[model samples]
Target: MDTKLIIIETTTDDKEMANKLSHLLIKEKLAGCVQVNQINSYYEYDDKINNTVEYLIRIKTLSNYYEDVKEFLSKEHNFELPEFISYECKEVSKDYLDWIVKNLNK
Candidate 1:
């Protein structure tokens, strides 16, 4: 069977925003765990190259809860087009995957 765990990645402009989103995800049981990191990002927007210091949020949760997570981010994120991406974890440890499933509401 395929692993049910997924890693959701997104960037936030500030630490406060990242923490707020993390708390929402955990409190709502949409994510089992969230890791926040400080990152320097470079990207192109409106034909201009931009560089920024941002927070990278890695959210771990069951794949089934992704839609709810996406909805919450869409409404709460500060960016016009937030970077929300999910990758199925093909080789997560059995115990970790179990933890994610157990923490999810559903």
Candidate 2:
């Protein structure tokens, strides 16, 4: 059977935090894999423009776990308002998709 999947995205200013989140998700079976990328971000907050280096975390997991993942991220995240966005996977490699489903514990 083809499994439904989603990619959840978030960002952190510290690599340690990124690693922590990544490991937590995998250890809890919330995500099959997490990819971290160093990125430069510029945005406005509190009436000022800000630029900073950040780590983008991409979490891949079954679509059914989206809400659980979102809740876990919000509670464990350090940011006052963490970015928790999800993109549904319309297409994925059959084998890779199977791997993701197999990894989920719930």
Candidate 3:
């Protein structure tokens, strides 16, 4: 079977937490690369609509590391209920895919 490439996504309201998580993932070799972007999110809770600014963290890694990544995020994330979503890359460039595989811990 081909190597499964996935992009795990999560959000955080704290900038420091986002940076910390990104660094931890890369340093631990759980993620090949991590991208963080500031975003505005609108959601409803307790029958009230709320809008907040957050940091969107996109983690690039292999499927084999998903569980580790999830665990790390769950433990380090500041939000009560963090968003842990993964999207498999159906089509990736050979060069990019190889780079990701090479960067991840064996």
Candidate 4:
């Protein structure tokens, strides 16, 4: 199985959403770990040229699970245009990578 790290963004800055998603991912054995952080302004959308707060969730999972993870995100996400992005890991610390594989198995 290939390991992948996904970055998902939401419209609202509610920490609760991040927490819930993280728990769901782990509980369902779809992701190893999820870290949510408050980030500065990135871009404007919907004619709103202003600064806003946002949370970035970093999820660790296998490549094959992206579709399932995306589905779960889409169904639970409140934003109409939530960001669904993924990054392939070419190299990672052995210990960390092993942790991901272990936690992501049901």
Candidate 5:
């Protein structure tokens, strides 16, 4: 079977948490690359609209590692309900895909 590439996304209200998670993922080889971006999130909760600044975390890894990555994030995340969304990459450059595979743990 061909190796499947995936990108998992999540958001945290704390910047420190975002940085820490990103570093941990990389160090543990759960992810080839992690990106943290500042973003504004608007949602409805408790019958009220709320807006907050959040850090978006994007994790790139192989499909085989998704479970491990999700477990780690679930254990370490601070949010009551952290966002854990994964998108399968249908198209990726050959060089970039090779780099990801090379950097990730076997």
Candidate 6:
């Protein structure tokens, strides 16, 4: 039995955002893992160089607990509208997904 996983990509590239997100997710037992990556993308917002650093957070958890997870993020996130997107994992090996389930409760 595994949880439906998702990614929460934030606009900020700051390590602080990554760390806080990971800590909060795990602390609440809503996710097993939140892998963060530094990504660079170019954008045009307000005619400004919106080239920014962003974090790609891969979250793992039980499929049934998604609502609680969403609630927590909605209340805790600092941004007015944080990037919280959940994608269905089309394919996953049992071993890897099981590992994610195990590490989340640690």
C-alpha RMSD in Å of predicted model 3 compared with the true structure: 1.4
Each candidate's lDDT (Cα)? 0.88, 0.92, 0.92, 0.76, 0.93, 0.70
lDDT of 4 by residue, 1-106 (tens): 6555444434446778888888888899878878888886667668877677877788778788888888998898767767787878777788987878887764
Ranked by lDDT, the better of candidates 1 and 5 is 5
In model 4, what lDDT does residue 48 have?
73
Off by over 4 Å in 3: none
1-106 per-residue lDDT for model 1 (tens digits): 2248889999998899999999999998889999999999999989999999999999998777788899999999989899999998888888878777777744
Candidate 4 residue spans exceeding 4 A from truth: 3-12
**lDDT against true structure, model 3:** 0.92
Error of 6 at 11 (Å): 4.3
TM-score against native, each model: 0.91, 0.94, 0.95, 0.84, 0.95, 0.74
RMSD per candidate (Å) reads 2.0, 1.7, 1.4, 2.2, 1.3, 2.6
TM-score for candidate 4, please give it: 0.84
Question: Which number leads on lDDT?
Answer: 5
Candidate 5 has what TM-score?
Answer: 0.95
Q: After TM-score superposition, what is the CA distance of residue 46 in candidate 3 from its true location, in Å?
A: 1.2
Residues 1-106, model 5: lDDT tens digits = 2368899999999999999999999999899899999999999999999999999999999999999999999999999789999999999998998888888845
User: How would you encode candidate 2's per-residue C-alpha lDDT over 10-38 as one tens digit per residue?
Assistant: 99999999999999999999999999999
Better of 5 and 6 by TM-score: 5
- Could you tally the backbone clashes for each prediction? 0, 0, 0, 0, 0, 5
